[model samples]
Target: MGPDTRARATSESPAGREQGQEYDASPYLPRRGGLAALRRASADCRGCPLFQDATQTVFGTGSPTARLFLVGEQPGDQEDRQGEPFVGPAGRLLRRALAEAGLGDEEVYVTNAVKHFKFTTAPRGKRRIHKAPSLREMSACRPWLAAELRLVSPRLVVVLGGTAGKALLGNSFRVGEERGILRPMPSLEEGEGEGGGLLLATVHPSAVLRADDREAAFRGLVADLSVAASALD
Candidate 1:
């Protein structure tokens, strides 16, 4: 095959996503008001194919004036059904860790990098299983996130898991190498100072559930979050 053809066949989009599908969230964002309006408008977001199967648009929740902004990969089964981010098993653990780390939900705003729950069903039970969102979807849904950041204007941003890290820090970002250390937030093309929040990369609370040594993983996640708390001082 020729170079251009091979490039198209073998490679992916700017986010290194295979370009499986495309949906845009911008059209729904422009006329929206602040957080509440955005939340309402997101109900109809057809930004990508993910919304096709998800129960509802799981949007960000918390105080708009929050100092700490936390972003996970996306909604899980419970979250999709509840129409709120971080409201599942992972969310419970996250709340516990945040409390232990000296952060509280009142002072924090939580969201997902991709707002929808992407999943596949198991044959036996027809159970929904979590699936990682592609880079294209992340890219597509980013405008909503951008609007969120603009309105919230948080002091710190904590990116949970590799998906969120990749969505913000680029595809090559590794949470293992960068977790706990504060880095400048990557520009979302929102504005000059819009992405200026101190960023902390860490594993999602779900990681603790999947870890062979749950204690170790939980400790590591808490430790990273503690650093974010420290940034508030």
Candidate 2:
């Protein structure tokens, strides 16, 4: 691949991950609205072929009245079977940490950039292991994510990782550089859902779960989340 096609890399805690390179979820459909109907309507999503392998499309969870919305990259192994976002091991870590960060899972609406489970089938002695999604994959799933954003219209949106960051902020988003930075939720404002919505970026709890020093990475994750917690203060 050309250098221009290279994955943007970062120096985080995830040991086995191709550090510095945040994978893209999709590229084809960029629309960020009309999900409630589209999800109800389409039996098949031509936007991306990811739906073919996934069990079912996992949509966002929480109340329309929630003040905060947290977005992650995509679903993981356990989440795939559950048909909900953030139900996997990583999600459990997030749930605990987010609570310490000053919010409960119920207080924040949670979702993924892509609603489906995307992984490479591995021959684990007759089983499969999980892998990350590609940029094109993330892009294809963007439309559904956009749809969730419109429906929830959270007052604060926390991007849990790069995929969530790129989907809303653009390709050059760097969590290390921009963590704790909250920007106006332009789309929410434009749609009249909520005013003063803030968008912040942070390391996904999953990233910390994969870290060499899990405790340290989690602490950092919590510190960033503390900023999120303080958004209400």
Candidate 3:
């Protein structure tokens, strides 16, 4: 296995985490419409400390008018390097499953719950490990997420893993328990539209790729993606 693959398996912590530090909100966040507005709004989003250690905030990419919206946690190392969300090995898995579900990359907008990459540094090396962002950070970054949701306004929103599900749906949502279930989302806010968007929970692609039981995890992920397809109706 490659060094990256090994790290993917064993390392699961952000490089620099300081929960005590409060993130400052963007005072004059951009209000323009479309993806450009999102880019501008994310520019000064000091909503969390994850932005500090990350190279740059990798925003969501793909078609804005897509019928489906896929939400992940945050950027991985490759994503950080590319300054685009979900462009790594996990992303490839996501793309494959999406295709299998009769969805094209152009048919959905993909993003994350947390906007920035959160990681921890290894004691001996410069490597920054990935860590799950706390609920606090997720909440802090919620505005940006809301903005994206406001624009994309996808008919179906798929929470790709527990993190995305917990942040968008609720904390009690067990991804394992709820995987493949298409549940009507509770009203998020006024701008989120009437009755809110449909929500589905599934395991993150990284989990599938890094698991000891790769086959099981991958199959489970595929099953969840197929559910996403069914949810589109």
Number of the top candidate by lDDT? 1
Models 1 onward score TM values of 0.88, 0.76, 0.84
Please tell me which model should have the higher lDDT, number 2 or number 3.
3
Q: Could you give candidate 3's per-residue lDDT for residues 136-205 as a string of tens digits?
A: 8887776677777878778888888888988787678788898888878655564554446688888899
Over 1-233, each residue of candidate 1 has an lDDT whose tens digit, in order, gives 24564345233332223354455677667575799999998886766666667788899998899989999999999998888888889999999999888886348899999998999999889789999998888988988988898899999999999999988877998988989999887778844543677899999899989999999899998899889988898
- In order, candidate lDDTs are 0.84, 0.69, 0.76
- After TM-score superposition, the amount by which residue 81's alpha carbon in candidate 1 deviates from its true location, in angstroms, is 0.9
lDDT: worst 10-residue window of model 1: 9-18
Over 49-93, each residue of candidate 2 has an lDDT whose tens digit, in order, gives 456566667777777667888899888878878777888788889
Runs in model 1 with CA error above 4 Å?
Answer: 1-22, 190-194
lDDT accuracy of residue 42 in candidate 3: 77
